[model samples]
Target chain A: MEFKNVTVVKKANIYFDGKVVSYTVKFEDGTTKTLGCMQVGDYTFNTGAAEVMEFLSGELSVELPNQKEPLIIHSQATFEVPANSSFTLHVKSIADYCCSYAK
Target chain B: MEFKNVTVVKKANIYFDGKVVSYTVKFEDGTTKTLGCMQVGDYTFNTGAAEVMEFLSGELSVELPNQKEPLIIHSQATFEVPANSSFTLHVKSIADYCCSYAK
Candidate 1:
């Protein structure tokens, strides 16, 4: 199902010198999400709250701090990251993702 | 430069049975843009006005009606499509693009 009621945020954010770009969206229930794209590179991200990431396109290799092996996530797949922890993403290609945060 | 003022649209449009998905953004200048991702497939799109397409990541092979050869667009590249015409996009890999329409 598509999100027909969420409002797209007004501003865009560029991360890691433009290697990653994302826009924000606000839902009716006062929750927010971010839709972003990552370039072909390795980058580290720190999160304050838990995140559920949904892959829109391309492939992504994700490595959590506690995981031994990197998880290969493809299109239409979902992954989870814990709060107060950091994760590394090794992007093989242009990858699009939607990140939903906990309230 | 990033667009910090444009607002993301509330509704999401899914095309070709979810092969392509896009979200709208409204600028302060009264123009609108669409940020979308395309899966691995070849699809056709018809436009009502002139469009400027910018590649965010990955690669795309585009074929216009008047052009005999397909144009390969990579990251940080841009292409134009005429108004009231249809163009075909051959997506070899997952690609991310931003499309702006002429007012």
Candidate 2:
């Protein structure tokens, strides 16, 4: 799959000292998303806007706010997180993902 | 800087066990580029097409073919590699780069 006719930022968004990296993609409708990857590690992210994370590959376990237990994902999956909230991820392997933000 | 009116592939091009990761960006005129990053490590890459590599940030020592004493870059720089040739890199620090292909 691909995103056509969009604007892609030249620089990358480096996080966790480069363990997490993403590029910002902007659509014509004023929506923005990030194509990102996470190396095998644990990370915590605080979100400003609500987000939907779509995984393309790899295995991971996510801890969302007020969740009973961590969500274990073996393969491709999608998950949502609320705005002004935070989540944790234990990436068992290299995880490739796309994250779209709520406007 | 950014590329507008382009198509971005959703999946990442993972290389060397994810030590080097890149996203393919396609232009309207049948041109292509990759927005990529490299973690601190030694890597060798062979190119199919001639490429111009533009560095966004980082420090590294590069060994191009037929050159003595690797080129050391402390910040932003650009390097050209011939098609069907190989180059080696000793990434002293994480490097973010954009590579454009000749067509």
Candidate 3:
């Protein structure tokens, strides 16, 4: 009998903060990473490599208190599975979730 | 008001897996990541950089049902604050939290 199977993979969270600007990005293969420069607001600055293979990419919403402006996050990724195809994800968090920027 | 100020930083999670063998490591700065070659068991293989600055290092317990062997996680980190001081942390999870090695 022919059969089909499905599986889901999970990952770990690497929190980062700079108080200047930052970013965190994920991949479809479940490999998540983040990196960037924070601005005047308090935000998590995930420390990821400057370069990676081809993978999934998307945006993340960050909400912090006293944040006059929304933090812009950019994550570019590539995966080992894909021979070449790649993309980028840009998400601007509301700063509500991470309110460390509250003054 | 001549007061003291203290703050805490949080991080995000990124799930990863390989199946032959795996590992996950975290730093005091809230930077958590995982990597390794999975064996015959299943565990979350968080994809982190092969190298990091200096920071906090610790152990994690992973307990997965049907997991006969315990997964070993090693994370070595350094910090940008420190000039050079650094160390390493190795954790052996009971395979309970992220149990996917059941085959």
Best candidate, DockQ: 2
Candidate 2, position A61, lDDT: 95
lDDT per residue (tens digit) for residues B70-102 in model 1: 998775578899999999998876667789999
lDDT scores in order: 0.76, 0.94, 0.27
| Better model by TM-score: candidate 1 vs candidate 2 | 2
The residue pairs found clashing in candidate 1 are none
For candidate 2, write residues A10-80 as lDDT tens digits: 99999998999999999999999999889999999999999999999889999999899999998699999
Candidate 1's displacement at residue B37, Å, is 0.7
lDDT of 3 at B66: 38
lDDT, residue B22, candidate 1: 71
Q: Candidate 2: misplaced stretches above 4 Å? A: none
lDDT digits (tens) for residues B2-54 of candidate 3: 00111112222232221122223333344433322211233333322333322
Candidate 1 chain B: 10-residue stretch with minimal lDDT? B1-10
Model 1 interface DockQ: 0.09
Ranking by TM-score: 2, 1, 3
User: A16, model 2: CA deviation in Å?
Assistant: 0.6
- Misplaced by over 4 Å in model 3 are A1-57, A61-103, B1-56, B61-103
